[model samples]
Target chain A: MYSSLILLPFLSVIALNLPFRNLMKKLAFVVCLLVLLVQISLIVCPSICIWSNDLDIFGSFLQFNFAVDNLSRVMLFCIGIVLLAALFVQRYIIDDEERIFNFVNVLLLILIGMDGIVMVRDIFSLYIFLEITAVGSFILIGFNKDVDAFEAAFKYIILSVVATVLMLSSIALLLIVSGSTSFSSISDALKTSPDSLLISSAVAIFLCACFIKAGLIPFHGWLADTYSAAPAAVSVLLAGIVTKTVGAYTLIRIVNSVFGFESSINSLLLVIGIISIVIGALAALGQRDFKRMLAYSSISQVGYIILGLGCGTTLGLAGAVFHLFNHSIFKTLLFVNSAAVELETGTTDMNGLSGLSKKMPFTAMTSVVASLSAAGIPPLSGFWSKLIIIMALWMSGFYVYAVIAILASVLTLAYFLSLQRMVFFGRLKEDSANIKEAGLGLMFPALILALIIVAVGLFFPFIINTFILPAGNILGG
Target chain B: MRLFWSYGLFISILCIIGFYCILVTYNLIRALVGLEILIKAATLLIIVAGYITGHEALAQSLVITLIVIEAVVITVAVGIVLGIRSHNNSLDARKIRNLKG
Candidate 1:
């Protein structure tokens, strides 16, 4: 039955392309909602697949061998929420029938890839699923087929191909050494102390590929460009959870289960995390475009997640997981807010927007909530997660990283406040007289997300106990 | 064993040249050629690794899957390059510079 989690989305991709355009849109939305419901059910019941020989491809079992652990549960929940929001917000932004159809189709295909990536146990299968996600994303990023979109997509594909090539080489090396591609087999091989430089090189190569995927400092060239150039809904999906899932989650999982938390790897994560935090936030401060700022903000925020995981403690892992969830919610909310602004104003330049609060109260108010949370203000979801990560870093004796984390949060606040002031709080622009509030379709999801941020903040203790702690336990205590 | 190591060394050179082509070349098609070279090196490494481990079947399967994925990726990439060329009238990477900070 867990196979249905992947099967439904795969089916939806076909259903999305059906001839009746209007029906396809509604069907696509409904199907995504149903997908959310299925995911929620999985979270509640929590089934696991030890092994399944159903497909028997290459005379090897590859069907539904899902490891529905706590980590997968958290990710599955976030994916459902993010996809639902993306599909919902998409209606307001896109009008072309063919574009809408293609958008919905690719989104569903992405869902299939994501579900497989989180659920699969074998490392080889994980790479396949990651590629699936990457392929779908490449198409979606260029879905508009505009010159700018295609250019961004080309850069994305080039970087992704390089990363995948390195990953394949690493996998080849690991396969030769371990004689198997399963995580268990590989971990067992590592336990025997293969004191060889080749092994470390393979691991380093794999992590480098993952870092590239995650958009760390040295490997982040493709990130801001792709995020800003994609359509707003696609941007929301990409920034909100795609990068986290495809890059960070996979990295954390491999580190936890396969690599077993070597201090060297931990230091690498810390250093990269610190660099991304400083670089991303500083870059964000200089962006004129509204969405572009958010893209850089995403890179910075992702730095915190990695930093927390790098601490290599249970609390640190919990903080990372919690922050990952919090980041997805507020980031998607902010992007949705951006889309609403863009919808009414027809531009995302900060200078072009002024006193938008008067015209679009829902978007303006939600943007405040999302950005405030993102800036790590007290009594919001982002604060608790950031605090946990900082506490984890400090407790682990990484005082320097802890300081960097705090400084970056202050910088986060400064930029987000500037963003809020520039775009929403100033005098209403003279050219903005005819602008109106965004439609309910767009406003509803942002409002829902804002509410979630508040609710998660208010109930932080319960959420940590129920979700984040279990996820951290899976990593280590 | 020596033969496999030599093959690995050769693949490494191919990969380094491919990467250099990708990072240094101005032409989009040359970049694509670089990508192809990188992929070939990876495929060869996988086969060699599989041969050394006596799991040639697994390696063969991985190579097959990699080839299929590579084909799709290259096709899409070529299509994207065509789109870029048609839109910008140049296949030089420098030509498609509309997006920046």
Candidate 2:
């Protein structure tokens, strides 16, 4: 089951770019549709293996291994939704068919990496997927050929390469310890960790590598610049799903499932989480660009997930996973909305213009809704998740962390409101009047995201049960 | 015995030199060279660790695989760096400020 759900995306991605370049959009849509169908099948059938062979050559033949659990199924579903929506709306951003083909192909490669990362059961294979995603984005970031795009792409490359090297070395150490690259076998080897000193140092180095990729407080230098400089679609994808899958998701998987999420590690993660929140929020609050602010916001929000993991309570784990899902939805929506506004208005700078609400009402309103969801207002997706996390914090006997969490929420609201006011509400600048709404290509992603935001807000219990609970149960309870 | 000790100490010192190169240099090309040094040291350390621990499979496979991946990564990275330099005439990261606030 996991094999089909995961492998099909990659195969279809390559397949979509073959001789039938004219039908690229239809091909991508079909691929997403198929993947979604398979993902849904997991609910009932739950495990399908397309390539299963008990007969091994002992060590001669190259092997392909994959399986999809509830965790991967959830991530695959999110990837499908975003990919389909992006495909649906992509045409609006381009008039050149040639450009569309290139863009769609790149998007599929990214989707392939995301699917591969989640389903991969081998650490070496996971590293390959991680590098593919990072390098793929590094190339995509400079797609615009603009000055900032080139610079952002360069910085992101250097930082990601360093992190990847660190990760590889740690994996090397892990291989020496375990003698196997597969996660199942590595888990068994980890059980034989006979020395405390080695375990402590190895775990620390591994966590450092993960933290760099995850952009926890001190290692977040590349995030904001990269987000602002990348194209709108790419920005939405990065903000929505990229960091969560490669960085946070991997960290959670390794520490909680692989390394056993011990108390010392748990406490260590809590410190990182708290610092990420305070520092990310303070940095975000000073941002003048809307997308850069959201990038910083992603750093702070990632802190919440870490905090939830650190608490090691069932509720905390559930809240964390739930927030992971919720953040992907609204944050992607926020980026898509920003993309729409930038497309119509010709600028993303807060100081550039105003009176957007009068001209681009839909874009303005969607931005407002997405921002509200991001800030954790009542009756939205963000609210329920934030409420659960703060409650989890209190339940864990960390009142100080809980208070800081609330303060961060308010701080979040403060910057977003500043963004909201400066971008949408004021009188129209002289040249701002002719700005138009984004066409279907760009607006479609935002529209779906907007509806889903309100839908998740209104029907909280259903989401909590279907998506969050199963994954939460797996994480802890 | 001197050969063994000298080779080990030499590689370790080279590793430290590489890291310093990364820290003090703002040129992207130089930093890339620094990272190459760091990875080389790491590979050496891994081999030594494996030998000390008597994990032969890990020692051999790791040293081989790290060398291959690092080579490919460096190739692609240098190509991109050259592309950047062609456009801007500078490989110094400090001079590149188009992406900042």
Models 1 onward score TM values of 0.95, 0.89
Give one digit per residue, the lDDT tens place, for model 2 in A1-477: 345554555666778767776777545555655655555455445444533433233212324456566666667767766655555545566556666656666776776678788877788778877877776676667666666777777677677777776776667667667766788777778887785654566678778878888888888888888899888777877777887888888887787667776788888888899899888988888888878888998999999888888887777777787788778888887787787777887778878857888888888888889889889997888899888888988998989888988998898898888888888898988876568777766667778888887898899998888777677676432
> DockQ (Cα-based) per candidate?
0.81, 0.44
Per-residue error for A448 in candidate 1, Å, reads 0.9
Best by TM-score: 1
> What is model 1's DockQ versus the real complex?
0.81
Which residue pairs collide in model 1, if any? none
Candidate 1, residue B38: CA error in Å? 0.5
lDDT of 1 by residue, A276-303 (tens): 9999999999998999999999999999
Misplaced by over 4 Å in model 2 are: A16-64, A88-90, A475-477, B1-15, B45-68
Best prediction by DockQ: 1
The TM-score between candidate 1 and the true structure equals: 0.95
